[model samples]
Target: MSVNESNPRQLKLLAAVRERGAATVEELAQLLDVTLQTVRRDVQRLAEAGLLARFHGGVRVPGSTTENIAHGQREALNAEGKSRIARAVAGEVPNGCSLILNVGTTAEAIARALLRHSGLRVITNNLNVAGILAANAQCEVIVAGGTVRSRDRAVVGETAVDFMRQFRVDIAVVGCSGIEADGTVRDFDLREVKVAQAILAQGREVWLAADASKFNRLAMVQLAELSRFDRLFTDAPPPAPFPDLLERAQVRCVVAGADATGDPTP
Candidate 1:
């Protein structure tokens, strides 16, 4: 089922599984305050859509390294978390600065959050982001030339990479399909990975905008390492080993809507 067809309960169910890595039918039913039959139905639908994997009596996120979930489903997954991450990233952006926003639903959300900022120049490979920022009169939006992937309206390929190399910007706000346990940031598309790498190289400071769902998730193509980022903006505290990893990498972690201020590492 498409994300549009998924009810609020299904989305909540998905979030719960993501947080815990797996959940039984009884656990989901209790957590969602729904009947066992209802929980089973939701799990079936989500699993059918490749968003979850069904076992004998429970569901877990699908472990697919070569394929990503549908674009629509990804846009709806952990939406509130993505919004919080957007706001936190926007909070750090100054009024006047240049930044490159790469492809992802979170990057599109960040574009919306940046609409009120003035005297900003934004470059993006995602058509959705360019359209959102276009409404902001003060922000100059530049679109990169490349082969557009119709699935997500993302411009990828070597042309996009060459286009990004044309200018160095203040910050690169990037999103990834997954972040592995070994601190590798990954994506499903090699073309997109090349463009993202170019965007990273062109930025004076790089900030990674990802929701908690991305942590420990697996994707096939390696985009970059966690150590490459100057900051990580997320909705909740990262799970075990990440806090220590970020500390060693000197990458400031910002837990949005939390007490930590994510100040620059001295």
Candidate 2:
């Protein structure tokens, strides 16, 4: 096929990369039906455009890359509030249960709470969670192997979804980038939704843990219907159509301990 300039071959290549979850030059060449040299040229151009990440002989989704941050840095940002919310979520997980934790900063807090518990198996795509649990002697933590999105340290793509289906989880603890009055779950990265959906399939119950900021904004992908989740944990009461929507969807809303002041907040 001839490449189009307005929506050029590089764009097509990036879209294809997003779809196939491929991370290398070889994989891109095979998928695009081009030569290695051509793939290299396309890749170089895409890299220059900030549309793709160049790895050794491969590429990765820019926003989904896994990362490591010092505990001090994480703790400094809303530490006490996140800790309370995490503790509340941890109470929901009984001993001897399997859970799927999504890749989000808030969900990382929940995973932190889980680190103190025993006999709980957590399958996750969050590198932050995985690392925390690695030091814990109590919980069994399994990382979903796939291309790591360095930006968020979220494991994503076909391989991650494929691995998630191997076992069922008692609960899937997830964080959404945004929420709608209609009870829709949203995220900017559509590929991450594929991984989230897979995790949903494995869980008997789905709990969405979102901060107040998730309201109003719209994330690009809808991982699943809000009705699919059994519970929604948030720092404050939902606004407007949110309550009605969640009621219609039959999702129980659990508000965390108000806000930092122990009063009602978003």
Candidate 3:
């Protein structure tokens, strides 16, 4: 089934598993206030769609090193978290500055959040991001020239990498398919990785925008190390090792959707 066809319960189920990392059949049933059979059915459907990975008794977010989730599924997954991350990133972005946004659903969300900002120059390799930011009259949107990936309207390859080298931006906002325990950021496509690396090289400061679901997940191509980023914006505090990793890397971690006192919402 398409992501749009997923019911509210299914979405909630996904959120529960995402927040907890994993949940058993009984746990999910109780959390959703549904029968065990119903939860099983939903899990089966979501697992079949590659939105979740099923083990003997529970489900968790998929952890495929060689393949990223489908674009639509990724958009639907952790959507609220992505929005929070976007807002946090946007809050830090100064007006009248130039930035490069790489390809991802989260980057598209950031584009939407940036609509109100004026006198901004935004360069992107994602068509969706370009389209979203195009509505902002005050923001100059530049699209890189390259072969577009039909899956998510991302422009990648050597041409895109070359296109990004033309300017040194104030910040590069990027997302990854996964962040490993060893502090390696990763993605599934080598061409996309190359383009992202180029974008990072051109930025005076680099920021990573990703949801908590990406923690400890796996992806094939090594994008960059966590140390490369100056900041990390996400919805929740990262699990163990990452806090130490970020501290060592000297990357500031900003938890969005936090209370006014600056504590993460429970």
Candidate 4:
């Protein structure tokens, strides 16, 4: 369906999310007196615009009048999608391996997969990730301490940079706020970008774990060109020139659809 076909429902869903903070498909279906599938379509459309995040069972109001967003809400959006990416990433690791996971929402999903591995060494600046892995007796988790951003919920600063330099890893699974046709990986904040570069520098194999929303959008800062990546694992195929551009850059673009079990949505 075209944007025009979905715009009205999108706006209504957006308002509903704003008023209630968040709403599940079932709730929206009841409120709008429509099929749950109709609510899903509206949610997917708004999500593509980056106006709202698609959650597991619902959608969250993006940004806010009184406060910024948190990780708790984002974890719901594409829950199965994230899990698919996580299991794929985990499958790449051996029994004893060291890896760097950047502090991004998708990266968080990858971290969850790491929990299933035994005798693993993990490096990250994300306090949430470090805390989550601490419970696994078979895994060793390292934290790069630095100033914390409550709004973004990640640790970043010069201290984090210095800490990252101390170790080398087999893989670095980072996140991108946005990706351009030119294969430039961007992030919303300069501080975050700077830290991501540090993580990339410490690893030989750089695996960027992202969903399809990351494509065609440019974050405020461009940290690395697409050529720097060894593998790009995203949830779906990118629009237009980006796919061609990534190929030209010699970057391996491996697309795993959000619904990996099925083909890409038309």
Model 1: clashing residue pairs? none
Instruction: Tell me the whole-model lDDT of each prediction, alpha carbons only.
Output: 0.86, 0.71, 0.86, 0.73
lDDT score, candidate 1, position 189:
93
| Model 1 per-residue lDDT tens digits across residues 1-266 | 43335554675687778768899999999999999999998887778667789989999878778988877877876676677778788888999999999999999989988888999999999999999999999999999999999999999999999999999999999999888778999999999999999999999999998877677777899999999999998877777678888999999998886332322222
RMSD of each: 4.2, 14.6, 4.2, 8.5
Tens digits of per-residue lDDT for model 4 on 23-133?
A: 899999998889988888888766765557777899885652223234554565455656666766676777798898878777877777777789899999888788778
Error of 4 at 140 (Å): 0.3
Task: Please report, as a residue range, the 10-residue window in candidate 3 with the lowest summed lDDT.
Answer: 257-266
Displacement of residue 93 (Cα, Å) in model 2 is 1.1
My TM-score estimates for the predictions, one after another, are: 0.84, 0.68, 0.83, 0.73
Q: Whole-model lDDT for model 3 versus the true structure?
A: 0.86
In terms of TM-score, which candidate is strongest? 1
lDDT per residue, candidate 2, 1-266, as tens digits? 21112123454566556545556787778777889998887776555544457878887655632332323333333344465567778877787888999887788888777776788888999898898888778788899999998777889999999999998888988877667556678877777889988888888888888755355544567777888889887765666668888888888887777333322222
Count of clashes, each model: 0, 12, 0, 3
Query: Could you tell which candidate, 1 or 4, scores higher by lDDT?
Result: 1
Better of 2 and 3 by TM-score: 3
